[model samples]
Target: MAEESGGEKTEQPTPKKLQDAAKKGQIARSKDLGTAVVLIASAASLLIFGKMLAIAVLNIGQRLMRLDQKDIFEPNSMFTAWGDAGRELAAPLSGIFLLILVASFVGNTLLGGFNFSWEAAGPKASKMNPMQGFKRMFGLQALVELIKSILKVAVVVGVAYLLLKLFFMDIMALSLMSEPNNIESALYFLGWLFLGLCASVSIIAVVDAPYQLWNHTKQLKMSLQEIKDEHKNSEGSPETKGRIRRTQMQMSMKRMMQQVPTADVIVTNPTHYAVALKYDQGKFRAPVVVAKGVDEVAMHIRKIANEHKIPVLESPALARSIYYTTKLDHPIPEQLFAAVAQILAYVYQLKMYRKGKGSRPKSLAKDLPIPEDVRH
Candidate 1:
């Protein structure tokens, strides 16, 4: 047996281990990936629908600003105008919210596929433990997260500075241009800055995703002893299984030996093989092999035949053929019919002579008519 200490985890986690972990809501997931994806998607949605959103906001502002004196004084008119403003904002706001929701879902799915686990949602005491909380806050994972956050901020700031330096002339010219032209130039600079930030975050996400998966795998690794215990729990323990097998074999042997008394003759390969055969013209067309065994079981078969006063014969070829070709309680093949018939006839003659009913027949034929194809 392989020995393993609990401290060293050497075995790869089995499928069952992974499945149980999943049931408990333990899975590899990259928060960085999800964050990056949501940021990119939100930026893209704004770029695509920014004009429509601006138009909606402008229309609501214009309606509110154009109210007559009577409309402003009347409480009913004020309420109606507020309701109109809400209705105008609803479609644009809902579209942006739905886009963010879908982007977050897609981002999470890309990292760990879809997983629904009630265990993750349920409250646990461990989460409230101060020591555990402290460990989590100051652990290697926390350190890695801190480094990532610093790197992301640094990269974004550096990129923004470079972008502003490259567009310094254009930016200064914006002051000399009209208001509309200045707004357009500012929007263009913001778009490029957002894209640069998204690109940097995406690079971090790509690296972090694989690292999270590797760390999860390492956490789930098992020791050799754990693997063996899991196997014993899933399948039965080896010692118990061995006992069951031995008991079954003993019962089978008892049944086989009981059938020996009914056999007409027990043929043997002198010491190695034993085959018990019986035939009745009115019942079986061919001789039936009642029992068969090898070595120790063969010796036991011969001992039972002697106690029952049943005839025993030495015919290695016939014994091997019957043992190999016939199953217990099944008829021998047609090829061995002639050889078995001769053995049965000789045994019957010997019984009759011993009872003083007739003289003994000639010695049984040594070269029984066994077919070449059926020989073991």
Candidate 2:
């Protein structure tokens, strides 16, 4: 077995296994990817609407800082005044928050097939166990997380240093400069800095996303024994299916034997094969194979035909052709119609002559007019 011998999973997961995992919310996801996406999206939103947002924030700040004399003495007026200022800023604030929300959703759902399950969301005892926590700390996933954190910190520091170096003069000017326009410039500069930091950190997301997907697949891979067990569960045990098939074949043969006694004639290969045919002028356009068998089954059919007094004709070529080309209870192929018609005419003549209505017909010729394609 793939995994059972060495406890290593080697088989790819089946579709059913994937579905079961999805139901439990064991879906591949990278926290870093979601974080990067939100950060970048928020930065993009800021760059696009920086001036209007900055103006809104400044207007709200000024209104909040400069309290009215009546507002200072009366709490209701102060509350009303602050509410109006915050409401004016709400649109820009809502736009930024909404971008973050949408970006995170896109990033998380991008790699994994989307699945949400309460069972996965629910707390587990393993999460609370100190021993499990300790083991997790030393795990490969924990190591990867630590490395990612370090890389992110390094990226952030590097981007910040580069931004400050490029715009040191601009930063100094912002502090010394005047009100609204300087605020706009400052917000614009911060937007660029945030965008750069996030875009640079996204290198980790690019690496992490594929790794998380592969790791999730690795975790779910089946062993050979597991695949076998799952197959049995889904398709039923092979041994049981074999027994059922044998029983069905035996029942089918029993039914075929029952048909042998009712046949008009039994054509035979002398010892190897037997095919019992039936025909009725009003019921069929051609002869139908009622039953057929080989060797031991053929001998048994011959014994039954003898007991039932059905005519047994030993036309080896015709018998082999019917046995191979015809199906049980179905008319013979069109190519054999002439040959079978000859046999049926012979049987009819024999019957008539026995009732003394016509002269005894000549004994059936050994070689009937069998078509080349219908010949065995």
Candidate 3:
């Protein structure tokens, strides 16, 4: 159905997809590489410690065979004999086991590093589904695995045959020698045979490593829709992001409107722009823009200022400068200091006149000390 619907996987897998796959223990790893390493390690360990292992085995065999009838009849004596035999075999057996263990660890690490995932280890009912099991068994992946197994076995057998044929003369000559000489020669021949077999398997491992990685990557490939969905999941859906931005802007506007009522005076570009300013002689060194906006938000600021009875002044240059250059709750630029100071003084005097403490001040100067560069 997926194929019919054009859901073919054509896109490269994203980093997030790869990471998720790793978390599920679906990383590329070659079991053949591990098998080859173990085989080689085992062969090498035997070559290095074969003499010690032979001596230990001979000693244990002799001791068991030389046991007297009385020793066998007595339970304690029989137990003691078995314990001694175990001690004789312990060193060589432990060394071989350790070698194989280290080899397996190194081989696995070289491919995928260590990974732990409960999801991979846990049993699932889907695995027991007959259709699913049949699909898996007859899938392309299974076919590839079968072909690899066949090739590996055929290569190993061919190597063994060639090695035996090459050493056939030496093996034939071994029978002409004494028993001890013949045994030593046979052991040497077997070591070389083991090494040859390991070499053959290593070739398979080298080939299988890249094939495994390619297969794993192919399995993880994404379709166009899958890529789009993954990107949306990572970055947030467009509609959700747009809603968040709108909510933030609404909150900011509400906060700005709240600050407008506290402003000492409002500056306006008549209709387009409004900027509310506040200054405290003891608390603030300069007038700070309490609220500022253009268009609909400008009208909102002006309406809030009127409700609070804050003085409103028409200063197009000052309004534009404050609106463009200052942020809410931040002081106006040094270039606008003189012009702002004039406005503040006018407002202070007007307040005193309204309270009947002083005579009305002259109307604010038409040409306030606005800097040429400061005007937008």
Pick the lDDT winner. 2
| Tens digits of per-residue lDDT for model 2, 116-207 | 99889999998999999998999998999999999989988998899889988998899787889899999999999889889987989999
Clashing pairs in 2: none
- Per-candidate TM-scores read 0.60, 0.65, 0.71
Q: Could you give candidate 1's per-residue lDDT for residues 153-254 as a string of tens digits?
A: 887788778877887888788789764445555555565667667877888899899999999999999987788789899888888899989999999989
What overall lDDT goes with each candidate model? 0.86, 0.88, 0.87
Looking at model 3, the pairs that clash are none
Q: Lowest-lDDT window of 10 residues in candidate 3? A: 178-187
Compute the lDDT of residue 103 as modeled in candidate 1.
90
Clash statistics: count for each candidate: 0, 0, 0
Candidates sorted by TM-score, best first? 3, 2, 1
User: What digit string (tens of lDDT, one per residue) describes model 3 on residues 113-175?
Assistant: 888788989998999999999999999879988998899899999999999999999999998
C-alpha positional error of residue 333 in candidate 1 after TM-score superposition, expressed in Å:
15
Query: What residue runs in model 2 are displaced by over 4 Å at the alpha carbon?
Result: 1-28, 45-105, 115-130, 164-191, 213-245, 251-265, 278-290, 299-313, 327-331, 346-363
Candidate 1: stretches off by over 4 Å: 1-7, 166-192, 239-376
